[model samples]
Target: MARPKNQEQRRQALIAAALDSAGSKGLRSLSLADVAKRAGLTRGAVLYYYEDLDALLVEAHKAGIQRFCDRRDTLVQSLDSPGDQLAAAIRAGLPSGPDDALMRLLYEFDVLAGQSAVHDELVEAMYTRQLAIYTSVLEAGTASGDFAPVLDIETLAMNLVALEDAYGLHIVAGNSHITVDKAEQAMRAASTGLGAPPTPDGGETPPA
Candidate 1:
């Protein structure tokens, strides 16, 4: 007999299916039945996990954020210097593979957020959380002397966050035109723009 799926597995399956369906088409067009069909489960099963479309969407957005955060944490773990950690985290924020789809979902949220006051507040909170995460790393680097003392860490952090957001938009416009390698190079240059010198080994990559 086949093994029955666990609750966590089902949740993950639903999240994946929802993202897949919503990412390709705008969330405005997404329906529970669409996600159910994509996930290979009945609508009743989907509704059992998510009471309604709004509930499912909120859960999907949270899952996407959590997934991105997990990836960011894994990439920055056990790093010696704060500068390296900040650079690594910047790279982590970029849309990669499935992460691209998640980001597309975020863009959808941004649209919906414009229409509803509640969503606007939620998006603002999410934005602040992201800025705090990036800025904290920069402040740590400054404190440790890994980055120059004169650097404006807060301004730079915010700029990097904005840059990454724009870069994702460019990629979504046409993946063929934008490459992560180029984005990394641009980020490295931007990092150095704030009076922080590039690592000793060549000028492009931040020292590992």
Candidate 2:
């Protein structure tokens, strides 16, 4: 028999299994049984961690979003320089690779959210939390002068996220129009804007 896991470990294992299953089969046909089998645990074991299947799905969604948001929090917390911090946010939002299975699961939830009365609440909560976090980061950037002063924080944040989503689709379709590096440069330029006065040589200092 396998060694027993602690509460946190069991919870994490369930979440990871759910995410993997959702990524492979999407939320449309996902089942608690499948997740339990994938995690190498009994269905009852999965239930011990999650109250129900919907609860399990919610935890999976939380885990997926937490991956990106945790990186954002780390980058934001570590930087004293606003420029570098904003850059870090942009980087964090970028797709780490072409797979984007977690993103696909979230998208699947979104598409099915309105149709399924059973899943709507969990789906809506996921969207609300993700949007709120992105908006908060954008507003904080503006307040710190990490972003252009004129852009509306809420709109800009949404647009930036939209752009990332679009680019991610491009990658999924096997046509990479913009590299992550190019996206970063374009975003930085747009954030800085052409109208901003050129900083005189030696005006900007490196992060200490």
Candidate 3:
């Protein structure tokens, strides 16, 4: 048995193992044995930490959300300009590639939404958090006179989140149709044309 002091570490390790295992096998097909194999522990050892695979995955999903949204928001807040914040937020929200297990699991969570009430809540919470990022940035830019958005702040924020989710889906799905750079460029372009061009360095000022 893991000592009380190591319980949190053990749980975090299992969460990582579960994400890795499910990354390849997928959420619907994942099993406790799969996680155990990835973690090099017995199924019983895994059960010691989690009631079941679903319980473990619920925590894994929350961890993934925390890492994704929290890091992005923190980075956004670190930047002084709303343009820099918006640009940084968009870039931070994407997958590294098809092999990005974390992003893959996030999409899987969407598929699992109907399987349980907890999943439904996580999915909705993720969407809300994503929307809030853009909304907050856009509102700040508008208030500071940094952005002269073409659309209402709410509409613009919704469109940006939609683009990120859509492009991120394709990027993780391994579509040759779009690469990360293309997605980022397209999103930044959409942002610029929509009235919120990132004005830090690479961003163009919106049309007069």
lDDT of candidate model 3 versus the reference: 0.88
Model 2, CA-based lDDT: 0.66
TM-score of each: 0.80, 0.70, 0.91
Better of 2 and 3 by TM-score: 3
Q: State the displacement of the C-alpha of residue 201, model 1, in Å, after optimal TM-score superposition.
A: 7.7
lDDT of 2 by residue, 1-208 (tens): 3345677787888899999998887787888899999999899988877889888887787678777567667766686655555566666666655577876666666675676675687666654554565566556656665555565666666666666666655554445777766665565566566222112211233545
lDDT for each of the candidates? 0.73, 0.66, 0.88
lDDT of 2 at 91: 63
Check candidate 1 and list the clashing pairs.
none
lDDT of 3 by residue, 1-208 (tens): 5588799988999998988888889988899999999999999999988999889999999989988899888888888878888888888888888889889889988998888999999999999999999999999999999899988998898898899999999999999988988999899889988889886443333455
Candidate 3 lDDT for residue 186: 92
TM-score of 3: 0.91
Point to the candidate with the largest TM-score. 3
